[model samples]
Target: MIPSLRLLYWRPSAAALVRTRALLPMAEFYNHETGDGAFRLIQKSDYARALQGARVGLCLSDHEGPMRASVEYQLLDLPVVTTEAQGGRIEMMDPAHCRVVPADPRAVADAVQELAAEEIPAGAVRASVLSRLAAHRAALPGLIRPHLQAAFDDASAGVTLDDIGKVDLWRTRDAEVIRREVDAMPV
Candidate 1:
């Protein structure tokens, strides 16, 4: 943890670990337990308020599914210090406002400090996410058009594998599988 920084750990489980293990000593060293200094324990529900007050958001989990919290933080225009383990968060994050580091506290703290020192515009961060989402939405039809066309043509012709072009063979197999599954279902 950075000496000048105040970190709020929002996960109850992480607080429990700090209380039960060798981490407690480290927390004490940082004056985390006294609630008077560099570290504090907070509830997840307070995230919106916390992000508003905080200079950086930290996502340190080594394993995660979607990490919506990190995205929310970015949407709120806060810079994020995330572990490399972040899966979905990495995709939407702008490098100027986000740093992907190892799961070490020192690295996280350093990233936080670095980001804090920079002049990242909150509107830019929010715009990056919005633009990415809009691009994805715009591309949705392109992604599904071929499949929809294949389905429509297949329904009309009662498609056979031989009738499908090489590029669309996967769709032909998928249609066959669906047909087999439907035919096997009871009336």
Candidate 2:
């Protein structure tokens, strides 16, 4: 745990650990090392609660469809620093609330610092995201209506995994044995 929480660098999915790891140095620099500049990878839903005391958010993805995590930050009115995304995610970001920076520790750290200092209103950022989502939400019925019956009536196929393939691959290391090392964790 960071002694003082200033930034919340969220890994949108468990597989996205690398992106956050590369930038841990930035978290360390800003959080001043008592136990902070944190990263989250739990398969849990209380993500918003983790942002209770954070000042800025970091969402730097190389490719994403809509990048909901970045928008979540906006919904909470937390300023964000992000890299250019490949899947039209930037279209939903608020230009005044977010800074499109490179995926560098120094640049991101500076952006975090700059964003934290600015007095941006919560409503403005939230409105920016909502307004953009309006179009997608409005079109949702039309898109789903045609498939609604099939979606509800079709018999869904069960998941099939190759016996040799890894299970829980999202949170495992290569060739690592699966063990519950509860004793290794901090109290």
Would you estimate the TM-scores of all the predictions?
Answer: 0.58, 0.54
Q: How big is the positional error of residue 119 in model 1, measured in Å on the Cα after superposition? A: 1.5
Model number with the top TM-score: 1
Q: Tell me the tens digit of each residue's lDDT in model 2 across 1-187.
A: 2234344343345455456547554343322222253543432345566666677777777887767778787887777788866876677777788888887767877877887788987678878888888876665444434333344443222322321134543244433322333234333
Q: How would you encode candidate 1's per-residue C-alpha lDDT over 43-154 as one tens digit per residue?
A: 4555465556667777878788667767787778888889998356777788988999998878888898999899986588888878876776666545444554666754
**Residue-level error in angstroms, candidate 1, position 167:** 30
Off by over 4 Å in 1: 3-47, 146-187
**Residue pairs in candidate 1 whose N, alpha carbon or C atoms collide under 3 angstroms:** none
lDDT against the true structure, each candidate: 0.66, 0.60
